[model samples]
Target chain A: MRALTWQGVNELSVETVPDPTVQSPTDMLVRVVRTVSCGSDLHLLGGYIPFMRAGDVIGHEFVGEVVEVGADVRRHRVGDRVVMSSFIACGRCWYCRHEEFSLCDNTNTNPAITEALWGFSPGGCFGYSHAMGGNAGSHAEYVRVPMADHTAFTIPDAVSYERALFASDSVATAWTGVELGGVAPGDVVAIWGAGAVGQMAARVAQLVGAERVLVIDRVPERLEQVRRYVGAETIDYSTQHVGSELLEATGGRGPDVCIEAVGMEAHAPGPDFLYDQVKQQLRLQTDRPTALREAVYQCRKGGTVFVLGVFAGVVDKFPVGAMMNKGLTVRGAQMHGPRYIPRILERMERGEIVTEHLATHVMPLEEAPHGYELFKDKKDGCVRAVFTP
Target chain B: MDGSARWTAALVGALGIGGASVAATRAVQKARPRPRPDRWHAVTVDRAPADLQGVAAAPPEPLAALGDDLEIDLRPAPGDRGTELRARARRPGLLVDADVRDALRRSRSLLEVGEVVQPDEPGTTRRTVTSLPLELAIRHGREGGRL
Candidate 1:
């Protein structure tokens, strides 16, 4: 099987890799159909995620067909078209029972590493990194899905494979962000980053009764997509001041809720950006929280700030005082796919949300390295690059 | 027969039947123990010629073919730290040594899952030679429910 692997920082190659098989009782061997690049994958490509190893196949947001199943895999059968919840969740665990599938107890096969880093291990995920369970990613001809009955969902006939693929990670993550923000009727929601997740977050905010939404980004292409797909107001932070503009737009109250979709690799506006960059390069800080700082700083007092971005390791210069003084609530989570996948699929079927624009480029699996390059550099107006095997 | 005597006889018969059934079930289980899955062995080799620059790096094979059922992986550890070998058994009862089997299970859980899940709370990752009563008390204090 040929799969895209992380060779080093800024280095990716489509290499021949061993085919994946069912490894556990609840495992499913799925033939990869479509795997796409994600904004978060850029962190791995840029060496921000420390756990990635050379030759580790990279991809998580994908849709596939079940080609084989373990004896205990009862829910899915061979030839079933399925979309996997990027997170590996055991359905019977305590967290899963409560619908917090990302905190599942039994899936993170490598708990000690996370326990050492984060004090507790979260659910295992496909091909993110070893720290996230190191499950083979779906960028190949076939990938193994553990706890398949709980982690993989059958796509409804009404939903196309391209739209269903977003349900696997991007849409679910954005939905979780919207839920965490606690968007309400007539509320004004502000979203940072007009990338795939941010665009989806904006759409979900509207669906959840947020009357007015604003998407902030510097990229003209993404901001245009946000306007076309989500119908939300756009803010080009590079041209205009973000905080003052957000304050003025919300009638000086600021956005009722702020969503940070930009992860640790965010680009800051000026001199401060260089400080974070140098410190990050010096291994002084594991993440650059430029957008996070803005989200916290610019959020309305007594409002919620939802973090949908991926942050690995420690961060410095967090605005805790502002968060405390303003009575702001902060919430974050990895994509709890089981909690959101079904509902998002139903929304797609009902035509409440359309995600066809997310995949701007489609190519063969051999072009995955180039796909990553285009996505990482935000070149050629590529919102996302989907690869077919 | 007296009424009391008849009731007592019925109670005794019920107890005898229950005891006999339990004993028979235990005897059957002892006669045929449930089979255990075949445990494959795995180990880490600290390959030489290690250098910070231009290391002999290879991609981690997330999945490898060991047999029709078994899957194996040989990947460079995180950051090209070292090489790790992981193998799994498809069938029950392989010829791997007992100590090697336990080590493989522990390492595989760490490599695949992230942690070696403990059966109960109050259990330490450390190997302890504490008394049984202390261990039981610790487990009981942590959580009363059976894991």
Candidate 2:
């Protein structure tokens, strides 16, 4: 089987690897149909997480066909078309029962690695580095999905694989932030980063009745996409003052919900960008909190700030004083995919969630390196690169 | 000449006493290995205390593998948490922290999820020179958190 592997920092190669088998009682083998690249993958590609090993398969968001199922898998037949959540979870765990599927107690095989880092390890996530669970990623000819009853869901007949693929991670992640941030009807929502996840967050905010959805990004095309397709206002942070703009947009009150979708490796303008870059390169900080600090400072007093971006470790220059004095509630998590994927798929089927446009570049899995180059560099307006194995 | 001969004999006698004392100490140490930390390793299972009553006596296969070398205790966790399964090695043979934690973690998974989830089997990762250290770390890293 051919799969894209992480060779080193920013080095990806499509290699022929042995095919996966249904290894566990609840495992299921899925033949890849469509897999997409994510903004977060850039961090893995850049070696920010440090858990990725050479030759490790890299991909997560995907829709596929079930090739085989273990005896304990009670989900679907072998031929069923399904969209899998990037995060693998056991359906029977206490966390799964509480709809916190990402925090499953039984999935992460290498828990000690993340346990030492994050206190408690989250569930296994495919192609997400060893810390998230060293499970083989979905960007392969085939992948073995464990505990499939919860991890993979049957794609609705009306939904295309391209549309359902985003539900695997992007849309579900956006919904996670929107709900967790407690975006209320008629409340204003401001989101940082106009990538696929940020676009989805804006759309989700509107779907959940946020009166005003504003997406901030330095990218012209992404801001355009947010305005035209997602029907959200755009803030070109490269030119405008984010704090002043956010305050002005909300009539001096600021947005009720502020979401930072940009992760540790962010592109910020001016002197802080250079400072963060130098600090990150020097290993003085594990993550950059430029967007996070801005979110905390710009959010309305007593508002909620939800972090959807993936951060590996501690950050410097976090606005602790503003976060405290402003009566803010800051929360972040790896997406609880199962809790929201179903609803997202249903919405997709109804033509409410349009994600096909996010696939700016489509190519074979062999061209994954080039696709990632376009994506990582944000060249050719590559919001996401969809792959077919 | 007599004084020199006496000094040499005394030196040999001192070395002999020291060697004998070292051998005796090693023999005693071998009879009883050093103890690990006295802290009890515990996991809170979602199952009620009633289900875990007398669990130490019967014990699951994980704890049972340690046999009498491990001591087991079960108590109800406060505020509807669950049963707390606590264990500590009795004489430190196979119940090292890593092994004990893995066993306890597997016990929790087995009881909760009905089975332990396997990681990617027949791992497809082709070994590179850089990957060896991560693989080495993973071999010793089964205990999820509290590791």
Candidate 3:
């Protein structure tokens, strides 16, 4: 089977690998139909995540048809069209019981790796580096899905495969941000980065009754998409002062909730950008928190700041005083995909969310490297690149 | 001695007997059978193949030869992803109908939701723990991925 393997920094190749077989009674084998490139993949591609190896397959968000089911997999049958949550959960742990699916104690087969990193380990995530369980990614003809009953959902007939693909990760991720930030009626929500996740976050905020939603980015097309498709105000940070503009728009109160959808490798303007760049290059800091810092700085006092961007390591010069003195609340999570993907699917069915536009470029799985390049460079307004196997 | 002295001596003797009776009752309670923290499993470091030993909750030597419906527990070290088995289990295994690990995991599901529930197909992966950097801050951030 041909799969995209991560060779090294900025290197991706579609190589032939052995096809996956079901190894557990609770496992199912899925022939992938569509797998999409994620912005988080950029962190892995850039060598920011150190756990990635030369032959590791890379992709997470995907939808497919169940070709085989293990003996214990009761919920799904062969030929079922399913969308798998990026995060693999046991669906039996204490955390899963409380709907904290990502934090499931049993699913991370490589708990020590994550336990060494995060105190305890989180549930396994597909193709997200060894830190997230090192499960083979979905960017292949067939991949084995462990704990299939809860991690993979049968897509409703009303939802298209393209839209269902987003529900696997992007939509659920944005919904997790909204759910965590507690977007409320009449609240102003500001999201940093107008990429796929941020775009979805903006729409989700509106769907949840946020009165005003602002998306900030320097990319013209992305800002335009946010304005048009997502129905949110846009801010070109390169042109206007994001903080001042947000403050003025909110009548000086600042956005009630600020979501930082841009992660560690953010490109920021000014002297601090250079500071973070040098530090990042020298390996002195693991992440560049320009957008996160700005989110904390620009949020209204006592408001919440939800970080949706992936930060693999520590950041330098976090404004603890601002976070403390202003009585700000900070929270973040890997998307509890299994918990929220169903709700996202319901919303998608109701026509409250449309995702076909996010798949700006569609290509064969063999051309995955090109997809990555176009997405990394933001070429052709490619918010997401969906690949068919 | 006067009547007052006699009365005081009687009172002191009665108090002594009362104290001894209380102490005796506590001793009897202590001697009665009480539950020890259930050690249904014990940890060992011996390198062993669990599948070869079958489902014996007890150590190989004692329970290996006896096959009267057994249960076992072979797990990875608490924080170490199953690089090596933690070498644990109990003897006179719990009357379970499945492998010890599966039984415990299933029982957990049943207790939590009244049925064994799963999100994905249950399958096994080779337990390989590659040597990676183990900085607390590095691993901690990966938990509950903030992004």
TM-scores, in order shown?
Answer: 0.74, 0.91, 0.77
Candidate 2 TM-score over all chains jointly: 0.91
In model 2, how large is the Cα lDDT of residue A60?
A: 91
As for DockQ, the candidate ahead, 1 or 3, is 3
**Candidate 2, residue B128: CA error in Å?**
3.4
- Candidate 3 interface RMSD (Å): 10.4
Q: Comparing 1 and 2 by TM-score, which wins? A: 2
**Clash numbers, per candidate:** 12, 0, 26
Write model 2 residue lDDT over A326-389, tens digit each, in one string.
9999999889999999999899989999998899999999999999999999999989999999
Comparison by DockQ, 1 against 2, better one: 2
Q: Model 2, chain B: what is the TM-score? A: 0.68
Lowest-sum lDDT 10-residue window in model 2 chain A: A89-98
Mark the 10 consecutive residues where model 3 chain B has the least summed lDDT.
Answer: B123-132
Lowest lDDT sum, 10 consecutive residues, model 3 chain A, at: A108-117
Task: Give the lDDT ranking, best first.
Answer: 2, 3, 1
lDDT for model 3, please: 0.78
Candidate number with greatest TM-score: 2
- Tell me the lDDT of candidate 2: 0.87
Give a tens-digit lDDT track for model 1, residues A61-88.
Answer: 9998999998888899999989999987
Superposed by TM-score, candidate 1 places the C-alpha of residue A146 at a distance from the truth, in angstroms, of 0.7
